[model samples]
Target: MTVILNQSFTGISIGAVLLLIALGLTLTFGQMGVINMAHGEFIMAGAYTTYVLQKSISSAGISLLVALPLAFLVAGAMGALLEWLLIRRLYTRPLDTLLVTWGVSLMLQQLARDVFGAPNVQTHAPDLLTGNMSVAGVTLANNRLFILGLALLCALTLTLILRLTPLGRRIRAVVQNRDLAEVSGIATERVDRTTFFIGSGLAGVAGVALTLVGPIGPTMGTNYIVDAFLVVVVGGVAQLKGSVITAFALGVLQSVLEYSTTVSVAKVIVLVAIVAFLQWRPQGLYTLRTRSLV
Candidate 1:
C-alpha cells in the first residue's frame, strides 16, 4: 500500500510537469496553429538559465527564485524575436511552420551545446525543498510536491487569464477566427507576440522546476518534447481542461506501465496508445469553440 501510494505520488508530480510543458505547446500548436519545434529547446534554455543563477550568483536561494522570471523573460524574448523574424512569415502554413521551427530548434540546440558544452549539469534543490514527508509510511519528496503545487497554480492562473482577462479573450477570438478577429480591430500582431511570450515563459518556468529534479543539459528538452506533445495532442489543442486531464492520465498510466514492465517497453506502449487515440480523434478531444466565443 505504501509503495503504491509513493508511486502514485511520484506519477502525479511528473504529470504536473507534463501539464506545464504541454499547456504551452497546446497554445502554440492547438490554439495558435503553429508547430513550434523550438518549444522544447526553450525549456532547455530555462534549465540552463536556472543553473547559471544558482551556481554563479552569490545568493543561490534568491537567485534561483529570480531565475524563474528571468528564464521566462529570456525564453519569451527569444520566442518573440523568433515569431517576428520567422514564425510571422510562416503563420497559417502548417508544414512551413514545422520546417521553420524545426530549423530553429536545431539551431537553438546547437547553440546550447556550443555555449554550455555536452556535459549535463545538476541544479541543487533549495534547502526548503530538499526534505521529504511521510504519508501513511509513503515518503514523498518535498521538491516534487512543491513542483506539483506550483504547476497546478500556474495552470489555474493561466486558465483564469484565458477565461476572464481581455487579452485572453482576444487571443481566444483570434484563435477561433483569425480573419474575423482582425476585422474586429483586434491587434493580432501584439497578441501573437504576447502568446509567444506566454508559451515561452511557461517553458522557462518548467525548465526551472525541472532543473530542481534532474540534470540540466543543452539538449535536455529533447527528453521531454515528444511526451509533452502527446499530452497536448491527446488533451485537444486549446482546451486547458483537456490538457490537464490527458497529461495526468498519461503520466499515471506511464508510471503504472513502468512498474509493470521495463521502462523502454512502457514508453512504447504509451506512445502506441496515444497514436491510436489520435487516429480516432484527429481533431482532438476538446475542440475549442469556433463561434460564440464573443
Candidate 2:
C-alpha cells in the first residue's frame, strides 16, 4: 500500500510535467494549425537557460527562482522570432512546417552541443528542494512536490488568462474563426504571436521541472516530446482541461505499468492502448465546437 501510494504521487509529479508540455503543444497547434516539430528544442533551450543562470548566480535558490521568468522570456522570444522569421511563412502549409521545424530542431540540437558540449549537464536543485519529506511512512521528494505545485500554479494562471483577459478573448476569437475575428476588429496576427509566445514559454517551464527528475542533455526534450504529444492528442486538440486530465491518467497508468513490467514493455502496452482508444474515439476525450474555416 505504501509503495502504491508513493508511485501514485510520483505519477502525479510526472503528469504535471506532461501537462505543462502538452499545454504548449496543444495551444500552438490549435491556434496556428502549425505542427511545430522543433517545439522540443524550445524545451531544451529553457533547460540550458536554467543551467546557465545557475552557473552565473551565486545562490542556487535565487537562480532557480530567476530562471522561471528568464526561461519564459528566452524561450518566448525565440518562439516569437521563429514565428516571424520561419513559421509565419509556413502557416498555410503544415507539412512544410513539419519539415522546416524538424530541420530547425536539428540545428538547435547541434547549436546546443556546440555551445554547451555534447555531454549531459544538470543544474543543482535548490537546497530547499534537495531533500525528501516523510509523512506516515511515505516519502516525497521536495523537488517533485515543488514541480507539482508549479504545474498547478501555471495551469491556474493560464485558465485565468483564457477566462478573464481581453487578450484571451481575442485568442479564442481567432481560434474559433480567424476571418470573423479579423472582421470583428481583433488583430488575429497579434493573437497568434501571443499564443505562440505563451505556449513556448510553458514548454520552457516543463523543461525546468524535468531537470528535477533526471539528467539534462541536448536531446532531453525528445524524451518527453512523444509523451507530450500523446497527452495533447488523447485529451483533444485545443482543450486545456482535457490535456490536464489525460496527462494525469496517462502518467498514473504508465507508472503502474512500469511498476509491474519492464519500461519498454510498459511503453509498448501504453501505446497500444492509446491506439485502440483513438480508434474507438477518433475525436479524443473532448473537442472544440468551432466554426469550420472555409
Candidate 3:
C-alpha cells in the first residue's frame, strides 16, 4: 500500500509537469491551429530566465518568485513577436507554419548553445523546496509539491481567464468563427497576438517549474515537446478539460508502468495505448464545437 501510494504521488507530480507544458500548447496549436514547433524554445527561454535571475539575485526564493512573472513576459513577448513577424502570414498554411517554426526552433537552439554553451545547467532549489515530507508513509518531495500546486493554480487561473474575462470571450469568439468575430467588430488580429502571448507565456511558467525537477539545457525543451503535444492531442484540441484529465491519466499510467518495467518500455507501452485509443476515437477525449463553415 505504501509503495502504491508513493508511485501514485510520483505519477501526480509528473502529471503536473505535463499539464504545465501542455496548457500553453492547448491554446497555440490546439485553439489557433498552428503547429508551433518553436513553442519549446519559449519554455527554454523561461528556464534560462530563471537561471539568469538566480545568478544576479542574492536570494534563490526571491529570484524564483521574480522569474515566474518575468519569464512569462520574456517568453510571451517572444511569442507575440513571432506571431507578428511570421505566423500571422501563415495562419491558413499549417504545414508552412510547421516547417517555418521547426527552422526557428533550430535557430533558437543554436543561439542558446552559443550563449550558454553545449553543457547543461542546473539551478539550486530554494531551501524551502529542497526537503521532503512524509504523509501517511508516502514521501513527497517539496519541489514536486510546489510544482503540483503551481500547475493547479495556473490551470485554474487560465480557466477563469477563458471562461469569465472579456479577452477570453473575444478569444472564444474568434476561435468559433474568425470571419464572424471580425464582422462583429472584434479585432481578430490583435486577439490572435494576445492569445499567442498567453499561450507562450504559459510555456514560460512551465519552464520555471521544471527547473526544480530537472536540468536545464538548450535541448531540454526538445525532450518534452513531443510528450506535451501528445497530452494536448490526446486531450482534444481546444479542450481545456480534456487536457487536464488526459495529463493526469497518462502520468499515472506511465508511472505505474515504469515501476513494473523499464522507463523505455513504459514509454512505449504508453504510446501504444495512446495510439490504440486514438484509433478508436480520433477526435480525442473531447471535440471543440466551432461555428466556422469550413
- Between candidates 1 and 2, which one is better according to TM-score? 2
What is the lDDT, from 0 to 100, of the residue 188 in candidate 2? 85
Across residues 1-294, which tens digit of lDDT does each residue of candidate 3 receive?
998899899999999999998999888876568978898999999999999999999799999999999999999999999999999999889779989998999999999999999998989999999999999889999999999999999999988999999999998788667788999999999999998999999989999998999989998889889998899889987568888999999999999999999899999999999999999878789876655454
TM-scores for every candidate against the unseen true structure: 0.94, 0.96, 0.97
Model 2 lDDT tens row, 1-294:
999998888788889888888888888887877878778989998899889998899688998888898888888888888888898888788768978988999999999999999999978888899999998778999998898898889888987898899988898878777888999999888888999999999888877777777888889888888898888788887557888899999988889889999789989999999999899777678877755553
Candidate 2's TM-score reads: 0.96
After superposition on all C-alphas, the RMSD of every candidate to the true structure, in Å, is 2.4, 1.5, 1.3
Q: Any residue pairs clashing in model 2, and if so which? A: none
**RMSD in angstroms between candidate 2 and the native structure over all alpha carbons:** 1.5
Residue 15, model 3, lDDT: 94
Please give the CA lDDT of all the candidate structures. 0.85, 0.86, 0.91
Whichever of 2 and 3 has more lDDT, that candidate is 3
Of the pair 1 and 3, which is ahead by lDDT? 3
Q: What is the lDDT of residue 14 in candidate 3?
A: 92
Off by over 4 Å in 1: 289-294
Considering summed lDDT, which 10 consecutive residues are worst modelled in model 3? 285-294
Query: Best to worst by TM-score, what's the order?
Result: 3, 2, 1
